[model samples]
Target: MRRGWICFTFFATLAAMTRFSIPSSAIAVNRSGSGGPVIVSIPHAGRIYPPEILAAARVGREQLERLEDSWCDLIAGQAADRGATVVQAVWARAVADCNRGEGQMAPGEVALPLRAQFSAPGRKERAGLGVIPTRLADCGSLWRFPIDRHGLNWRLESFHRPYHVALSRELARARARFGHAVLIDLHSMPAIPAGQPGHGARIVVGDRFGRTADDRITAAVVEEVERLGVSVTRNQPYAGGHIVSAHGRPDRSIHAVQIEIDRSLYLHPDRSPDHRAVVRMSEWFGGLIERLAGIAPGEDEVPLAAE
Candidate 1:
C-alpha cells in the first residue's frame, strides 16, 4: 500500500512538471498607433488554464468559470480596433491573477524567495483573491494541496510577470506618443442580488476614490455610461485594485480608471454572454474610448464642476 501511494505521488508531480515546462505566451498585445491616448486593459477575461494548474484544481470547471470576466476581452477588442492599444492576459486568473499585487500571497502559503521584491499584503490578499488565489466566492478552495514555492514561482514568472510587463510597456508607448495615457482597466462584476441597495446600477467606475485618476476623467466616464442609459456609481463595493494603484499617476499625466460592467447586461441566464448584448456594449465602450482620447493631457487633472 505504501509503495502504491509513493508511485502515485511521483507520477502526479512528474506530470505537473512536464506540463509546466513549456513556455507560456500568456499575454497578447495589439497596438495600431491610431493616435488614440486610451489603452484598454482586460486582465481577467482569460479562459486558458495550463495543464499543471488544472491538475491542482479542487474546484469544478464551472466554479472556476465564475472567476473570469467573461467576454470582457471581446469588448476591449472593439476599442482596440478603433486605435486603442489593448493588452490582455490569456491565462486563466485561477492560475495567476494579473490584476493582483506581486506580494499578495497568503500566510505561509508558499516558501520561496521571489526574485523581485514585493509590497505588503492588500485587501484582496486577506480575502483570498491574491496574486495566486487560494479560494473563489462559491468554491471554498481551488488547490487540492499546498503547492511548493518553486511551482508558485514558476506561475509568477511565466504568467503574472509577463502580463504586467506588456501592460506597462503599452502604457509607456501610449504616453510617449500622445503626451498622455488613459488606461481603462475593463472588468465585469457579478450580478447584483435582489434587494441590494445599488442594484439598479449597471456600471461602476472606480478610481480609488479620486486617488488613481483625475476627478474630471472619472466624471467624463460616468457621464458617458449614464448617457447610454446605464446607471452608474463610483467607488462603492470595488474601488479599483492593484492595477490602478500601481500604474495611475495623475501628476505625470498617466491616468488609470477601472470600469466594472454588470454581468447581467451582457450575460445570458446560463452566464454566457449574449452576442447581441456584447455588440451593444462594445459600441458603447468604443464611444467612451473616443471621448477619453479627446481629453488633452492637462485637461484630465483639472477639477470639473460636477466633482
Candidate 2:
C-alpha cells in the first residue's frame, strides 16, 4: 500500500507548474446532508499546495498527483445529491494526508529529537509515505530537510486535524438525525491486473476487516458494485485505513467504508478525468448511497454513545 493503501505504480515523472494556491479555507463541509443518513468523504482529492510545501517537495506535480484521489471529489459530490453530507479536504495530500493517523509517521523524516516520540513507524511510514509523506515511488525522500516538531505539529493542526474534526462532526449529526450514519470514504487507485494472480479487483471495498462497519453494510457495497458488472473485492490489498478506523463505529450505529476505484476507469492517459466515465460512476455511487440509507442496525442491536 502506498501511503496507507493508496496503491500507486511507479509514476512517470511529469511536468506541471508549482501548485501555490492558498484559498481562504482548507476544507469544505456540507452538513445540510442531501436527504439521507449518508455522508460522503472525499479525503484525498485535494489539489491546493501552498508555496512552502511546493518548495519542500523533491518530486514533480505528476508524482504528487499520484497522491491525490484525482478529482474523486467530483464523483462523490455528483452522486451525493441524494441526501448525503460531503466533507472534502481542499488541501493537497502532499501537505498532510487526511487518510492516516495523526501519530503515524516516518521517523527519519522527522528531526532526530522529535523522532524519539514514536517508537515504531508503520511499514508505509518506513517506506517514506505516512501522515506527512516523506517519500514517493522511485523518487526517494520527498523533503530536502527533516521536519522538526514544530513543522510536524503545524501540518497536523493546520490541515489533518480539521478535516477529521469536520468529518466526525458530520457523522455525529447524520446519526442524530437518522439514528445511524454511513460514511463513504472515497478514494482512487492505480489499476490492478485483472485475471492475474494477486488482486484482480478494480473496486475494492474496505471496512477495516469488518471492525469498522457491520457485515450488512459491507455486503451491500459489494452487491451494488457487482450489480454494475465490475469486479469487486473485500479487504485484501486494502482493509480500510485510519479514516475508517477512527470514524467508523458500528457499535455506535455509525458505519464507515473506504472505497478505492481504479483510476484507469475514469482517468485519461493525459491525466484529465473523463466526464462520461465520471457521470456513470457517479450514478452508480449515488445509488449505492441511497441503498445504504435504507439499512440500519436492527432493534436487537444496541448502539453505544459516540465518545
Candidate 3:
C-alpha cells in the first residue's frame, strides 16, 4: 500500500543537489535516491487478488497460499533506501504470476483455455508454474474444473498486466536517467528438493548462461555476496525465469540477473518461523546490496546501449 518515491540528481559542476518527487501511481514504484543505474524487481512477492477470481479458484486457499515466495518482500523490501527502485507485485502469484510469460499453456492446452488464461513456453509452464498453476508444489490439481475463457481474461487484465506495466516504466526510467539499468530479480527457493541432492551452496545466481547480463556484473554480485560468508553458485537447479528472459537484453544496456536464496538458510522448510536466521540473512543481504550499489557504470564488460 505504500507507493515508492524517486530521487533524481543532475551532477553538473554544481554542489550536491537532488530532485525528490512522487512517482507515477499507476503502479507501485518505491523511489529511493537519484539516478543510480539499478532497479531491483521482485515479481513473485505479490499476494493481492481480485475478489471474483479468488472466489473462482479451483484450489483451496491454503494450497494457493503455500506456493508464494514467502517473506521475499521482507528480504529485499528496503531496496529503495539503497539507491534503487523496488517494484513489488501486490497480487498473489496464484492470481497471476508476473514472472511468467503471457499466454503460458497448462497441461490441458488443447482444451482451449479461456482468453484470460496465460499460455507460453518455458520450464515454468512445463513445471506447472504458469499464470495459473496446474499443481501446488507437487500436489495434484489446484483447479476443480476448467476455467472459463471469459474468467481467464479477467485475471490477466486485473493482475498480470498492471505488474508488468509498472515494471516496464521503472526500467525505462532507470535507463533514461542513468544511461543503463541493472535489474536484480530477487526471489527465494525451497531448500533441497524432495528426493534430490541437497543444494551445497545457499545462494544461486542465474544469468541465463551469460546471455541475460554482462558476465562481469554477474560476477561482481556473486563475488560480493560470497564475501559476506554466503556460499554462491551460478545457474544450477534454477536459472533465470520469465522476468530474466523478457527483460534481460545486455546488448540493449539492460542487465538482469535472478538471485535465488535458499530458504533453509533463513526459514524452517517445515514451515516454522526462524526469526534469528531471517534477521541475520536479512542483514547480510543489506550488506550485499551495498556492494551491488557500489558497482560503477561503463565497465568494459557492461552491455552496449540498447536500440
Candidate 4:
C-alpha cells in the first residue's frame, strides 16, 4: 500500500509537468448585477488557458488547476443575486494572477507594463506564487525554460491587464451607484493539516492588518463566519494580497477585504464541490453579502474621484 501511494504521487507529479491544448482568447471577465455597494472579486477561480500559454508551459493542466481557488466563483457569484457586482477572471491564474502585483517577479524576469506602482515582493512571490507563477507546490518548477519577453508581454496584455480593468470598472460602477463601495475578494485555501497552528480555523479574514479596509467590515465578516459554526482567524497565514493593496482605500471610502474559505467546506477530494455543500455555502455567502452591503460608509469614507 505504501509503495502504491508513492508511485501514484510520483506519476501525478510527472503528469503535472506536461501540457494541454486549449482555445485561444484573452482573459474573460464575467460580470453580473446592475449596481450595489459590494463588489466581489474572485481572481483565482479561472480555468481557461489559451493555446499559446499551453504550448509554452512546462506544467500540465492538473498542476495549473491545482493553483486555482476552486469553486470560489460559485460562492462569490451569489453576491450578484444580492445585487452586488461580481467580477471574475476566466483565464487560469498560472497564465497571469490578478491577485498578484506586476512587480512580484523573480530577478531577471520580464513582464508587461506596470498597472500600478511597485511594492516590495511579498511572501507569496518569494514562494513562487507571483503574478506569473514560476513553480507549483509539491511539483518543483512550472516552466521548462524561461519565458521569452514577447510571451510575457502577451500574458500581461491579454490576460492580466484585462482582468484588473474589469474589476476596476465594476468598483467604479458600484461606487457611482452607492456612496461608497466595499470589495470582497473571495478565495479558498487548502485545509490545514492536522496539528498545524491554524488547523482549527476554517476561514481567514485579511485586511492588510487594517490598512486595506475598515475595522468594522473585518469584524463583521469574522462574526458572520463564526456564526455559521466555522472557526475564523485574522491576519495569520494570509493578510490580503495585491488586489486588496491596490484597490483598498478606506479613507477614500473604497474598502477592500480578502476572505479565505477552507476548501474542505465545499470541495471534494477532486476539488469539485458537492451540490449540497455548494448550496449551503452559497446561501451563507449571500447572507454575508447582504449584511456587508448594509454597512454605512464611515465618516472618513469618501466617494472615488471621477476618473
Q: Candidate 1 residues 1-307, lDDT tens each?
A: 4543443365356646765453546877788656477888888998988766766677777787778998787676578767788888888888788888777766635434542333365566766787887877766877765545556766777778777777788888888877778899999997666676456688989999999887778888999998989788898767898899899999888899999998878888787878998888888898888788777755543222221
Off by over 4 Å in 4: 1-34, 108-122, 193-197, 299-307
Candidate 3 per-residue lDDT, tens place, 133-220, comes to 6665566766544544434454555556777777678778877876777888889887645555336777889999899888877898
State residue 203's C-alpha deviation in candidate 4, in Å. Answer: 0.5
Which regions of candidate 1 are displaced past 4 Å?
A: 1-24, 108-123, 193-197, 300-307
Instruction: Please give each candidate's TM-score.
Output: 0.85, 0.86, 0.79, 0.82
Say what the RMSD of model 4 is. 8.7
lDDT of 4 by residue, 1-307 (tens): 4543443344334334432112234444444444568888888988887655565556688887888899888776577777677777788888888888777766423323442332455667667787788787788777655544545555676667777777778777777777678899999998867887567799999999999888988887999998889889897768888899999988878899999999888888888887788888899998888877777656442222321
Worst 10 residues of 2 by lDDT: 7-16
lDDT (tens digit, per residue) of candidate 2 on 45-67: 88988666665566777787677
User: Model 1, residue 230: what's the lDDT?
Assistant: 78
The count of backbone overlaps in candidate 3 is: 20
Give the clashing residue pairs of candidate 2, or none. 34-83, 34-84, 35-83
Consecutive 10-residue window with the lowest summed lDDT within model 1: 298-307
Q: Which pairs in model 1 have colliding backbones?
A: none
Question: Which of 3 and 4 is the better model by lDDT?
Answer: 4
lDDT of 1 at 302: 29
Give the C-alpha lDDT of model 3. Answer: 0.66
